[model samples]
Target: MLTSIWQAVRRAVRPFAAAVVTALLGVVLLSGWLDAVDWPASGGWVRAHLPALAFFAVAFAFAVQGIGRVVRADRPARSRPVGLSWWVVVLAAAIVVVAVTGATEWLLAEADHATDRGAARVDAIKTGLGVGAGTAGIFALLLAVRRQIHQEHTAADTVLDATEKRVTELYTKAADQLGSGNAAVRLAGLYALARLADNHADQAETVLNVICAYLRMPHGRLSPEVSDRHESELQEAQVRLTAQRILGDRLQRFSQNPTWGGQVDLTGAHVAGIDLDFAGLSYARLDGATLIRASLQYADLSSASLVEADLSHAKLTRADLEDADLTDANLAHADLQGADLTDAKLTRADFTGARLPDGMEFRNGLVVRT
Candidate 1:
């Protein structure tokens, strides 16, 4: 116990001891006492400004301590109390007061060519005391302001932390609901995620990714045969349609509603007869997916991959298909009028009876001059 107490005391005194040593070293250097070749002029200057130099050394030591504390990553400055203690503040003020008094008296004596022992000396002391007190008050006010600003920042950080935690909780809960067996529950989850994404712009891409992933999951098409399986498939199709609608709503650029401009991953997704007109689907992946008769008019499909995808009888008027890959894609009877197909890959693509862009025609499964 005694040894532990001694260790704690040593730790407490270490910083103070270091500061004192630094201050003494600074004073010795300023005094030019350790000069290898002492100059008389340098010595005279040091003697003339001894008091100010001593104060500067003490200030330098304090500054070094403050900087060391700030740079020490192990301990945050916020963890400790800010500003000097009452006694330290009083001592600093007193030192300034005494220095100012002595300087004032010396100045008056030199100017008047009189002795430094009279009413003039007393007046100088009064003037010095008033100036020093005012300076101290100003410093105290600045410290108070700094403390207030720090407190406000801390409060803001706390609120931000709480908000992030709440958002995370909501996100996790909504994601879990997406895996529910009930179609209604899944639909609710989709809307919840959409709302969350709308409110938090930073999480919009993540939420959209989740939606795309859900759509990418396998789901059977509605069957003609009337049975329990058909009903279940129909219900599942409704859920899928809802998910598609959500994506369409956010992807539409012309719509007044908020649009999500992130890249969509619908690779191998079988979303047939979907309506995604005026949607911003830049860099979307629709490889090997079934999108027959899909309405994609005025859509931004720039840099998108639709390799081997079926788009038979799809409406794609005025669509932006720049740098898109439609290799082996079925675009039979699909509208391509006014569409921008610059740098698009149409190798082996079936564009039979499709409305081609002006000055272009389908020949040998590729776009060529009419």
Candidate 2:
């Protein structure tokens, strides 16, 4: 009866033993791969305490399995939820294992040189437990900090996403207002866009481009003739003037605000009587544009391209026109008093009746410095 009982126990344990051997083989293969990849945990303290760590891993697994089985047996139908309490228990178990492993290692090392083995063992145990507790505390603190940083990052991303969505909605609504039939609505749209650009520096160039494109559209000059068409043209001109004012305010020199330093492309745009005084318009492209009676006094138009542009009677007094290309441009009756025209190209440019700076003159359809 004793021999039969022993054989029965061996048969029951055979499958479990085979499973453990297979799991060990898998671990060995995994360790080899980790070693090949130079995994940081494969060396240093981990390598030195490999046996202890492996024992902890196996014991922890068994403990978790047993706890799960007990919970399931008690609950029968309801599933057990692994919560903070479970993690707390796991952490405590890990700390205990580390403390035991450290004490054992210290005790073994002290045994070799110990005159009084028992006292040496007690001292080693105390020192190891203290060090293990300190290390575990530091590890827990680092985990807490990491979790906090992750939560903050997630919240920041959410706020950024919401802000971007709001900006897009505002942009779409403002753009739609620009297409409205009412002049007041269009004017409101221009102001909305300007405010948006002012708040968001990244949107400044795009806003300027939209306003410039609007100015470039075919618009009849304000007419004195009393009619429905004249009334419509008058409203349109007012809207256009408001757009120009917005640009002028943003591009003003010495203004205590973020200025749009990018090039203004008003090519072929007709903006009669537009006010842009003291505007910073360096490198602007106004080629073939109509600027009759426009106020541009003291403006910075350095290196601007005004080829074939009509600026008849436009105010350009004291403007910076250095390196400006005015080839074949019409400047009849335009003011150039005290304007800096250094290195300016005036080939075939018409300057009939225009006021030139002192010691400067237009002779034979060309500007000449006396």
Candidate 3:
């Protein structure tokens, strides 16, 4: 009957809870199941001697553990216990068990075995041996639990290392694809890297840097001599728009959750018809870049460069352009109300149909009329 129950308990207690589960199962199974066996005398004696039964349960558990140690001699080493040696903890536990057991026996008149001289000495010796075996079993069980936990942690670390390696390989492959001269291949690479970044957020900044570099590359009509004369340029334009859309999507998400927080450098690169509304572009370099009809409402462009750039009909309402350069730039019909132009260079810059802020005038790009 106990065998069947022990097997059930062993199957039930898995994955974790080794020490506690074993101790509990041992106590319940070996206590002889109070319901199955009959107690001597009336129920009063058994009721009064409840603590004695508990001690017997605990001692039986330890004795079973001792047998297990003998059977498994090649068990793994134990980890160090926190702030206490294993033996020290075992000794303290043994002392407490012995005291509780002795008290229970004495209180329940079961100390009659120690009333005679010869039997008393034998009982003392037996008690001592039981405590010793229980302590040793407890020490072994603690060590076994620690070893199991350590093995699990090591296995988890191995799996994580393998996963990281695979991710790195995928990232390298996608980067190679992006560098291909074929426009279709480059577009595929962009989507692949974007997917990678989405799955692995830690790579978002690195992936973003690559996309930014591609946009920063000189590949516009201004450089038609080295530009691709084939249909690839038109396809590349679509690819650039896709890249801009991806980047702008991430940047505009700063209000809800900021994932990408890196500086963008599009100096001397054409960025027309891109939707960058509410994007975080502080300290960016857009000098000489054509931003015709670009939506930059409430965008952060503080300390940016726009020298000799064209911003005709661009949306700049409430945009942060503080300390930025606008020399020889065209801002014809661009909205600038609530825009910060403090310490910005506006020499030879056009602002026709653009709303100027208070204490500012567009003539000669001066804040005050001279």
> Candidate 3's residue-wise lDDT over 1-370, tens digit each?
9999987886565423545644764575467453343322434677899999999999999998999788567667554334444445544564556544443344334334445756665565576566667766776787788778777877887898998998899889889987888888888888888888877878887987888888878885533356546677777877888888887787783567666767777777677877888998887778778788888988998888888888999988889999888888899888787888888888888887677666666664544532
Off by over 4 Å in 1: 1-123, 223-230, 256-259
Better of 1 and 2 by TM-score: 1
lDDT by residue (56-85, candidate 1, tens digit) is: 999999999998776575654565346656
lDDT of 3 at 322: 90
TM-score of 1: 0.71
Best by TM-score: 1
Relative to the true structure, candidate 2 reaches a TM of: 0.68
Candidate 1 shows a clash count of 0
- Locate the minimum summed-lDDT window of 10 residues in model 2: 78-87
> Candidate 2 — which pairs collide?
none
lDDT of 2: 0.81
TM-score of 3: 0.63
What is the Cα root-mean-square deviation between model 2 and the actual structure? 15.6
Better of 1 and 3 by lDDT: 1
Clashes of each: 0, 0, 0
Candidates, ranked, TM-score = 1, 2, 3
Each candidate: what lDDT? 0.82, 0.81, 0.74
